[model samples]
Target: MDKSIEKKYIPLAAYFEAATKDKITLTFSEIETIMGQPLPNASYLNVSWWKKTKPPLKHFTAWTTFGYSVTEIKLGYYVTFEKPTTDSTSSTPDQDSNDHPTYIIRSIELDDARDVIGLYQQLFAETDYMLYGQNENNVSVQSFRKLISKWKVENSGTMLIAIINGEIGGAIAIIGSTIPRKKHCISIKMGVLEKFTNYGIGTALMTEAENWARTRNITRLELSVMKSNQKAISLYQKFGFVIEGERKKSVKIGSNYMDEFYMAKVFD
Candidate 1:
């Protein structure tokens, strides 16, 4: 199990992991007791809250990481989790070990504002490829919280973060216009921590963002990368983005001016 699972859901995950039965049911209050906290109001009022096994709901990863999924939900009353019936019965250490590192890619939430801000600061300092330099970011926690809330309410954009080894290792943002004439286009910006690069974090984030765009009828996904960032340029090219043009001296890093490639991917 991923230790990065939310603290509140750890106990619940243990409860499910220890279960001998294939199916388990717990009421809202029962779940609250198991987690040592009250269920969020949305859990009681919204069915989507329980049904959505995706990000922005950290608890979903908790149960699913333990091989359980929400089989049924009674809205305010209770929910049931069931383990899939498969021919393979046992999971050994050898079967679990893989070459790649384990990571969770999910939509960003308000609680992640501070961690994200810190991540951006660290990323900016680690490389000049980033748009801002160290200490150049002035985004406040409250301001970031507002931005998250806005993303939740609007259909124009979203942000996703990759949680690796229990920390924010990277994030990607898709920014699009709400105007009817330009709704088909979106711009991408992302960064991975220096130590977390080459572990497929950026690729995973890009894959998720592109899946999201395709589902939303977004046809053009575009971004600008500093010309000197060959690693990023190659990654973009691998994902079908093409260099359409160049912006001369678009970025200034200290005393040096850097050109950037305007790249985009148009979906069929």
Candidate 2:
């Protein structure tokens, strides 16, 4: 998947993201104009493709990510996008002028290994939802430096970290396989410090990951989330991920066996 192919739909996302009306409708031609491309054959032939559905279409994120849904579709004509009745349902960050957090998103560096490790230690201590506990991760900075070098050399993985107040606020990694057969598949892991939970750091990280995946020709992004971690699950769903299956007693925290869900988001 070339980045330009994915970028063609960005205009539509920007259009919807700037929407202020509760309900708006646009003709197929208008949408095409907004997207700078013609609609695919399925857009005219399959009504189901237009319905507001989960695991949305690859291009649908252009609207869905901005909190708009296709409430009604007229095949070969137009579609209606509406905001949810309650503002609580939207996963977008606050639209208020001063509500946005001040942070920068960037890829990791070898010299930052120590900080990254410190971040994971804090994350593990802050929550039990992570794969490793506070003391379980014994990775040395030297090993992490090697890992970072390998990821860069392979060009198949990305580990983005959010910088806030001169410190690492959060990190998100999309790890892909080197094997030709499984190159399209990627696994993701992310975390935000407790203090930055609702500041959109995670959302920004996910968006960047998806953008990177597109440029790299990755098609599937998957992750395992402990069943009890509903907050993380909801965030993932907002990004178009769906629960594909569950693993019973997949994680053991202390003596408690916890179930985890295998979730994935795919781009066609």
Q: Which number leads on TM-score?
A: 1
Total clashing pairs for each candidate: 0, 0
Q: Candidate 2 regions off by >4 Å? A: 1-100
Q: Worst ten-residue run, lDDT, model 1?
A: 91-100
What is candidate 2's TM-score against the reference? 0.64
Per-residue lDDT of candidate 2, residues 1-268 (tens digit) = 2133266566566566655555667787666644435778888999777763555246777767767778888898888877775765443334423344446566776756887899999999999999999899899999998999999999988688876533677999878999999999999999999988787888989999998999988899999999999999999999999999999999898999999999999898
Model 2 worst lDDT window (10 residues): 91-100
lDDT (0-100) at residue 131 of candidate 1? Answer: 92
Deviation in Å, model 1, residue 49 alpha carbon: 21
lDDT of 1 at 252: 86
* Every model's TM-score: 0.68, 0.64
